[model samples]
Target: MTGKERRARIVELLEGAQAPVSGTALARELGVSRQVIVQDVALLRADGTAVVSTSRGYSLARDARPCRLLKEHHRDDEVADEMYLIVDMGGTIEDTMVNHRTYGQMSAHLGVSSRRDVERFLDDLRSSRSSLLSGITSGYHFHHVRADSEETLDAIEQALREHGWLVPMSDYEREALR
Candidate 1:
């Protein structure tokens, strides 16, 4: 198949998938090298496809939900609590981001929508001895949160605020996010 045809197939596969599709799996299915699948995904992204890369693999971005970017700060010990609260309140923690003085912004896809996902994420961090991206920014970070409606997001925001985890965004952050 042509590159264009392969890319289209990638999109179709992702759209129909219930879970993220790994590049290796895509490559095998498309009869191409993994690098080719990676390049195809890059090209698809450049062409405006909402393909989200998560810890497991790539999936078509879910745009049906309303999302909000929330700035928050908390100690490492509170990570589980924060995640559980969001998921329990019907919000999906899509990703986490931090702005560094030198690097500007860095992010990682979380895809944490349930308690199980949260536990797996924390377990990975422990097993790998990896620090959270927010650690570089002194616990200050941003979360891309998605929920069924504006009201759900608002509830999550309020809960965070009540927990003292919510931080008011700096003017620079506001402008940069815009």
Candidate 2:
């Protein structure tokens, strides 16, 4: 099959999948090398496909409906505040998403729900001497918080906003994306 056709199939397969599908699995299905699959995914993303890379593997971002929520907090509170909020709401921090005015989309895995999960993730980061995006972004960050439903997610957003932890997405900022 041509590269274009193969890329289309890869996107279709990812969108239909409910879970992360490994590059090897995709390569097998497409009768191509895993590297080819990765290249195709990159092309697809460059063309504006919402493909998200998770720790487990790759999945279509649209396949996982992003819960409606907003959170904005100081860089200093990123660890402790995230842990308390996710645990209090009985949800997990699926990912951290940030919109760069000049750079477009950027995100990372957070994958946490409990205090222990938070501690372990933080510990791992420290042990690895790893740095986060915000560390390089002048302390600006955002998140794609997931929960059971819109209501639950909204509740968390509201609480955070009330506590001066979240900043509302202004009409101008929302319009800029369009």
Candidate 3:
């Protein structure tokens, strides 16, 4: 098949996927190398396809959930709690962002919508012994939380507030954190 046809199939697969599909899996399905799948995904993203890369794999943003920006702070050990609170409240932790003095803004895709996803992420982090992006900025960071409804977002915010993890920083306050 031509590259254009392969890309169209990739989009179809992502759109119909129930979970994040891996590059290897896509390549196998498309009868192409994994590099081709990766490059196709990059081109799809550059062309404005709503593809999101999570630790597990890639998925299309088919739901179009409303997103709210939240600033939070917690100990590294409590990252799971912060993530669980959101996913438990029917929200997806879309990504985490931190502003570093040198790096400006850096964000990591989380796409965590359930406890299982949280556990997997925590496990990987533990195994790799890698520092979190927020650790660069002293355990303070931001998340673009996506929820099925506004009420769900409200509940997640309330839960975070009660958990003492919500920092609620304004534009000026965020600068102060740096």
- TM-score of each prediction: 0.68, 0.60, 0.64
Query: Candidate 3 residues 10-92, lDDT tens each?
Result: 98999888999998899999999999988888656533356888988899977677777788899998998888888888998
Model 2 has an lDDT value of 0.69
Over 96-115, each residue of candidate 1 has an lDDT whose tens digit, in order, gives 88889988777777889999
- Give the 10-residue window scoring lowest on summed lDDT in candidate 1: 41-50
Estimate, for each residue in 7-51, the C-alpha lDDT of model 2 and write its tens digit: 779888887898999999999998999999888886665444567
Candidate 1 local distance difference test against the native: 0.88
* Candidate 1 vs candidate 2, TM-score winner: 1
Considering every candidate listed, which one attains the maximal lDDT? 1
True-vs-predicted CA distance for residue 169, candidate 3, Å: 2.4
Q: Pairs clashing in candidate 3?
A: none
Q: Stretches of candidate 3 above 4 Å error?
A: 1-60, 172-178
